[model samples]
Target: MIRGIRGATTVTNNDAAEIVNATEELLWEMIRANDVKASDVVSVLISVTDDLTAAFPAQALRRIEGWTYVPVMCMREIPVPGSLPRCIRVMMTAETPKAQEEVVHIYLRNAVQLRPDLSLTRKSEL
Candidate 1:
């Protein structure tokens, strides 16, 4: 079966270190939430809000996780006026036997404030 987890996070600034750390935290949460191993991740797509371009969040994850073998790509998120700022979003497609509803999604930081509907586990994980 194929399952996917989508995560989004808002950053306070455009610093590279901050970007890397925030993305690392988000990706870590996503991995742990679904019991997703490195091998389970089929591919990961990342996008940053227009204001953020210090470093690709995908590259940050690659460096932090030492994921020399994971397929990752990064792009710029569409900019709409008044949209979330300094945000890095991830959509991960994984190969798993679990149903779609069983997959875990992550929203972090001020991003959590964006989706109060998610469960406590999801809220606290990131």
Candidate 2:
């Protein structure tokens, strides 16, 4: 079955390094939380708030040892007033045996507000 795992995180600055680091952090957390292997990932779709034009969030995947083969795309999110800035979000599709209810979605930093119900606590065990 194909399952979707959603995650989001915020960068403190618009700098490329900050964006890449924050995106890497979010992706690792999601991978750990979902117990997903790179081989299981079908594709990853990433989006960033309009304010974050310094870097492509998908670029962070290069640092993930085995994720080189995973297909990824990045886009600019619609600029909504009052929406959080410097937010990087991802929707990952993967082939998994786990049911939808068992899938874990993650949100960190200011991005937690984007999906409160799916947000994992900082101390939550994966």
Best by lDDT: 2
Whole-model Cα lDDT per candidate?
Answer: 0.81, 0.88
lDDT score of residue 124 within candidate 1: 52
lDDT of 2 by residue, 22-97 (tens): 9999899889888889999999999999888888888899899999999999999889898888899999998888
Cα RMSD (Å) between model 2 and the true structure? Answer: 1.6
Write one digit per residue (lDDT tens) for candidate 1, span 60-122. Answer: 667655566889999998898987788888998888777986777888887766566774666
Task: Name the runs in model 2 displaced over 4 angstroms.
Answer: 120-126
Query: Candidate 1 has which clashing residue pairs, if any?
Result: none
State candidate 2's TM-score: 0.92
Model 1, TM vs. native: 0.88
